[model samples]
Target: MNTESLLRDLREELDDGGLRGSFLVRDLHTGQEIGLDADLEFPSASLVKVPLAAATLERIRRGELDGATQLEVEPGRVTTAGPAGLARFRHPARVAIDDLLYLSVAVSDGTAADALFELTPPAEVTRMLREWGIDGVSVRHATAELADTPAERFEPGEVHLAHALAIRAGTAGRGHPVSQLDVSRASAGSARAYVALLEALWRPSEVDAEVAARTRDLMAHNLLRQRLTPDFGSDATKWSSKTGTLLNLRHEVGVAEHADGQVFAVAALTESRVPAAIQPEAEILMARVARTMRDHLRSR
Candidate 1:
């Protein structure tokens, strides 16, 4: 099918699936690409961790921070729960800076990310990205800030109410009553921006080669595989990715390397119109849409 018809059909499919998103798939070698609203920015959720890892690694490379340095981490509150990693720690433990990077990216550990953030503040992360010539992604706060959403205020059974609020309370300008969901206030990036980041990691330019290599290694070990992994991973391919989620929003950005020496960078940033906390179908739809874009780019 032609690009126009494919995009139209994909857009319709996303609408039918109750999702609106920014998606991009690019051939790292040729630079050809395809997408839907690929430049539209959204609150990045845990996606900010990738840049955080990159910045942290860069600092280590500069000898400003030692990867072997261990920091004591206190256990997270039960109320501010997370799915895995340091957030669920029941006791204080000392973890090295390198291990914290692993927990932050591989397990989506917010506490580990915040610990790293203490060493390299949000402003410094942004500054490091700019120094490396990466743009469009802004890191304004630590991962702990993401846990303070209205979803926390609601009962677990009524968390969907917070999702509903997230769905309805956004402005056309991307402002949200919930600061975490607001692009202006939250860590934010577009699919295109993230794809650029992936490209930088996969094929370094201004970014330090060692830093990019370390970041890529961390993503390769990412355990949160329920998003784009199903569609991208296989015996013949390697999918290195990071997932970002906030109320009503789901996103993943990664590089897919095939056995045939082909490489592509994919980024999907989405928001659901539906008001549920767990939407398996939404995850499936995101994977399908991203895979479709990747298939199209490859076929060309």
Candidate 2:
């Protein structure tokens, strides 16, 4: 396919919308990355689940957490509206660690993430990331990275578990104070680093193989829609991803596998004053960029 033409087309579409933000797309195979204000960070929203999932598995690897650890569903912890809406467990159903992580990522389950955090929490996860060379993660909630972590003073040892679980619980339109600005303060992402994180999660040569594989496995089962690969191509185009949207932000960062060992890392973050009910416009913006990146990979 002619990728350049598609890129031009997508760029024009983005321009027409006048949305505010950055984007980044890279061909993992050829190592070519395209960026446009791609460093701007929006709320990770649910998108932060990707990294938090990695943190959970990494904890399991260290034996600090048994993915099989069970947790109970508690009131005030599980929102009445999100993935944890059914709430009526009085016995404290001890959910397994892996299951909790899966629920948190795949379904963006709030109670599930809360259960996991109660086990190992966010401050600890931030510590692990520091050892892993990850910087600029706002030290917000333990569940994800986007809305909570203030970019300027990321801490490896603060209680971020509650913050982590909130976004996953399906709370929409909430914004943190640090999230009011770009450059880490406003909890946003540039297309470049966002895609970089996905590479670290899916492609082993790019990140720890065990962590990447485990993370990919989690995403495959936690899809909210039949978009991307299935929407654009086929098994010839397999995508492992997690998306985030809240208030004025909409983002999706993931890995897509194409024919002939071709892989691509894409991050699409957009912002608007409209609410989540109007998120489709944001989706259209991201889809244009993602499709262009996929096409770009095939051209290689």
Candidate 3:
């Protein structure tokens, strides 16, 4: 099928699935690309961790911060919303900066991310990205702020109401009643911007090679693999990625390196109109759509 027809079909499919997203896939070698609303911005939930990791490593490389330094982290000191890492610890633990990077990026640990944020504030992370010549991704707040949404107020059985509110409360300008969902108020990025980040990591340019390599390694070790990993990962391919999620938003950005030396950077940032969470079908649809784009680019 031609590009126009394929994009039209993909748009229809996403609408049918009650999803609206910004997706981009770019061939690293040739700079060729394809997308659906790639420039549309979405509140970047945990996705900010990637930049956090990069900035932290950059500081380490510059001898400003030592990765071997250990910090005392108290249990439940940060947000308890996360399902993994230091968020679940029952007691205070002293974790090294390097291990904290692993927990923050690879495990999507909100507490660990906030811990890192303490060392390098959100504004500092944004400054670091600017210094690296990365744009379109804005880091405005820490991970702890992400846990304070309406989703947390609702009873477990009625959490869908929060999702419903998330779906219905957005303005055409992308403002939201919930600060965490508002692009202006929350950390946000476009698919193209994230794909650019992936490109920088996969093919270092403005970002230092060592920092990018370490960031890429953290993504490769990511434990949250149920989203796009199934489609992009295989024996013949290596998929390195980071996932971000909030009330109704789900996103994943990664690089797929084929054994044949072809590398494609993909970013899928999506918001669901569906009220219910835990939509495995939505996750599957996202992966399929992104993989289809990758396959298309590969063919050309």
Candidate 4:
């Protein structure tokens, strides 16, 4: 039941499942933790939604934005990647703030994230992190810069040149590898910052009440299918979360607050050899940790 034994068991489970790198799990209330390759930074997919959502709402609290404000998805704004919510619409989307937040959290909509990213550029997102008193975070590449991704990284300005370099140097504005991802629009984040965001949310003193509430509402609406939710874990525990995958990455992060107030915030992520269609295997590995942690807490 201790962290060392718990970590040893998790490593075995992930290895048996053929997972890559590490996953992180924490005891939010007690400050205890179990990590298998947790600190190793890997690309955070939709997991970035929590921060982006908090940043947008933080702006609203500052009067920099009106909560019900709207943005028109001009031809240039509409994109085919990410979640297909409005894209499923018959015409270009002129989504309101509510709808954008809904689609972003509910479905991990790439387009929705781009919309928010458009309103709050990555550099500005970093600013929000500092203002909120969160640390170990940096976001410099605007989601819109995705447009400059070279058709190939070998050729500068390809799809992900900006992002690729950023990830390598552990900083944003560096560059992203394009050619591989340039074909389609994409974005990235880190696990450490993601949890910091949730920690901030769980204890909203870091930001205004209105901002925390709105962001929580947005996340609440966006429910991800995970091992603990109705969709994946066979009704084990209800989870309001974001699920993400691409190439080799599989991830999910959210607050799992039980009826008893034994809330646990988990960020389970990994790079994997599994194909995109079956990436949930990595999540399943993380879920094993979640189930165990939940058991330990219940025993208390």
Full-model lDDT for every candidate: 0.93, 0.59, 0.93, 0.60
lDDT score for residue 143 of model 3? 92
Best by TM-score: 1
At residue 193, what lDDT does model 2 achieve? 61
lDDT of 3 by residue, 1-300 (tens): 999999999999999999999999999999999999999999999999999999999999999999999999977543324457788788999999999999999999888899999999999999988887789999999998887889888778888999999999999999998999989999999999999888888895889999999999999999999999999999999999999999899999999999999999999999999999789999999999999999998999
Ranking by lDDT: 1, 3, 4, 2
- The sequence of per-residue lDDT tens digits that candidate 4 reaches over residues 69-102 is 8888643433434335653455576778767777
The weakest ten consecutive residues by lDDT in model 2 span 78-87
RMSD of each: 0.9, 8.2, 1.2, 6.0
> How well does model 2 score by local distance difference test?
0.59
Per-candidate TM vs. native? Answer: 0.98, 0.75, 0.98, 0.76
Give lDDT tens digits, candidate 2, residues 17-57: 64555667787767787666676656566665666778778
Which 10-residue window of candidate 4 scores lowest in summed lDDT?
A: 178-187
Which one wins by TM-score: 1 or 4?
1
Candidate 4 similarity to native, TM-score: 0.76
Winner on TM-score between 1 and 2 is 1
